[model samples]
Target: MKSLKLDYLKSLKWADYLFFALVEPRRLSGKIADAASKPLGGGIAIALCAVFSDILAASLLAVNTRFFYYKITYGFLLLSIIAFVKVLVTAGLIDMLCQFMGYPGAVRTMIVLILYSLFPQMFLLPLAYVFKVISFAPPFFYVLFSIALFVWSALIVITGISETHSVPFSKASLMFIFPYAFITLTGFLASLLALASVFGYFASI
Candidate 1:
């Protein structure tokens, strides 16, 4: 049987291209130029990484909450499941945007790009939380981290979309807004429904 790592490497080596995803996103455009030909392993890797990232973040927050720090309330398993579902929903939302915009990209391509772009948030969350615990940090520190993470993720996605779709940067930015809003709304509604279900279950019990 062929290995997933070998499968991923068939498209692009993770060790090398991950740097491009970090410092030079434009480099990934050519690597995935033909989405149909690219190995699905890349997308799988991103999804798994994203799920584990969320779980790791949840674990760190679980410990930090006890220290009177970031108060996250989900257990690792729940958070991991939520992360998996979230990636699917967000990828679907991006596909919707692509359909509306008449962009000629596959849904798989969108999913891969979106998750790849979010790689930084996955890697940084634990470090940021640990750093804050090690030293007293002001609100500004978190604000800065949030902004940096947003810009970093946004730029990578925007760059990917622009280069892959041949869309102009300004238009790409506008195109991204719809999926972003959809993702945010989807998460919000999911949260409210979950809360309502919990309350209803409590009332029944």
Candidate 2:
């Protein structure tokens, strides 16, 4: 009976370890560890980092175009820089957020959650362009850029989640996709309304 009790205690301890392992900073650290062990995984992480950088660049371009009225050529250059920085920052943030979530690691388990939360805007960019609502940059570039962003986010999430959760890529991919779609829809609608208000204000002027 005492042996049985000891075994149960051991099992409980293992379960606790596994549960906390899935949570945050530790999870990110685990991914880093896995990547170090596997060359292919390291390569994937690098690619994912680049993708995130591009998304950041595109987002910066959009904002600059809207508020600063920067020339297109200059805006593109700025976007490129932003994208590079974004990937670096995002990776770090993922690490931090993971730690906050009780997971520690460089693998970035929440990358999927972030991407899934943001990707829907890709669909909205074209519609916003077609409507001729805003005088900002071209719609096609934004949409294309957004696609790249989505891809990066998806990759990061997939790699991170698979490493941290020991889940298959196929399953984690779904978690990235659906939530992003919903968030994108919400953001698109909000953008449409804001654009409409801007147009109305301009016409009144």
Winning model by lDDT: 1
In terms of lDDT, the poorest run of 10 residues in model 2 is 112-121
Over the stretch 59-141, how does candidate 1's per-residue lDDT look in tens digits? 55344445322223345446556655666666577567777778774666656676677667655566556666775462345
Off by over 4 Å in 1: 2-12, 35-39, 50-74, 125-130, 138-143, 183-205
| Top TM-score hit | 1
lDDT per residue, candidate 2, 1-205, as tens digits? 9997679567673233223323442454253444423323333333444344444444544654453344344654665456445544554554554455565454343432332323333344444454334555555656665676566545645555556655577755654354445457878999999999999999999
Q: Using alpha carbons, what is the TM-score of model 1?
A: 0.66
User: What lDDT does each candidate get?
Assistant: 0.65, 0.48
TM-score of 2: 0.33
Would you give me the overall lDDT of model 1?
0.65
